[model samples]
Target: MMGFAVLLHVMAVVIWVGGMFFAYVVLRPVAAGQLEPPARLTLWAGVFGRFFPWVWACVGVVLATGLWMIFAVFGGMGGVGLYVHAMFGLGLLMMLIFFHVFFAPYGRLKRAVAAQDWQAGGKALAQIRMLVGINTLIGLLTIAVGAAGRYLVP
Candidate 1:
């Protein structure tokens, strides 16, 4: 049961973090170089439409499995190490950032794309880009912490 919960948690993390990595690192540059603003915006909107739902689902799985492990396997917050606490804190921060991005800039991006407002879409996309960049960095750091934390954090 513990292993299963950990597996789910890791998979969710991989999906969310890996998606952000690809979007920010791989796709963003190619899209910007190849496509005009209108086409780029449309492509981003379409991409987000497909990706965000999976992110939301990943968020649910991560939260549920993480909490389950912390409680059921590790015997709750009090019983966990400093690394666990740090990971939890970082995870919550990442989730909050994601929620903000989804509700604010992402919402505006979708609307702008729908309305064919390239300028507005560009602005929204820029905001999403910055936020996702931050999240990706944090995600990488979190992964490092999760991987090496047991040995490092006393």
Candidate 2:
């Protein structure tokens, strides 16, 4: 059970964080350079439409598995080191940011795309980009903390 939980947790992190890395680092520049505002906004809306659902799933699995590990493996938060705490804090922040992106900017982006409102879509995309960038950095940091924390935090 513990192993399964750990595997699910790691896989969820990979999906969420890796998706952000690809979108922010790889796709953003290409789309910006090759596409006009309309096409670009449309592309982003489509991309997010597909990716965000997976992110939602990842968030669920991550939270469930993380909490399971905390209570079952570590015997609750009290038994964990500072690194675990840090990872949890960062994860929560990332989740909150993602929720904001999905509910606020992503919604705007979709509506703008549907209405062919390039300016509004651009604004929404920009907001999403900024938030995703911040989340990506935090996610990377959380991964590192989760990986190396036991040795460093004790």
Candidate 3:
């Protein structure tokens, strides 16, 4: 059960963070250079339309598995180390940022695309880009904390 939890947790993290990395780093630049506003925005909207559902699933699995490990396995927060705390806090922050992106900007982006409002879509995309960038960095940090916490933390 513990192994399963860890596996699910790791997989969810990989999909979520890796998706953000690929989209922000690899896809964004190429799309911007090659496609015009309408196509690029549409492409992004399409991409998000496909990807966000996975993110939602990842978010659910990550949260559930993390908490399960924290409580069921380790006997809750008191049993965890400083690194675990850091990881948890960062994960929560990332979740909050993702929620904002999904609920606020992503919603706007969809509406703008439906209305063919490129400017509004652009604005929404810019917001998502910035937030995703921040979340990616934080995700990386969280991974580091999870990976190195036992060794480096208290």
Q: Write the residue-wise lDDT of candidate 2 on 5-71 in tens digits.
A: 9899999999999999999999999999999999999999999999999999999999999999999
lDDT of 1 at 6: 88
My TM-score estimates for the predictions, one after another, are: 0.98, 0.98, 0.98
Candidate 3 regions with alpha-carbon error over 4 angstroms:
none
Clashing pairs in 1: none
In terms of lDDT, the poorest run of 10 residues in model 3 is 145-154
Tell me the whole-model lDDT of each prediction, alpha carbons only: 0.95, 0.95, 0.95
Put down candidate 3 lDDT per residue, 1-154, tens digits, no spaces.
9999999999999999999999999999999999999999999999999999999999999999999999999999999999998988999999999999999999999999999999999999999999999999999999999988898867
Q: Return the candidate ranking by lDDT, descending.
A: 2, 1, 3
Would you list the clashing residue pairs of candidate 2? none
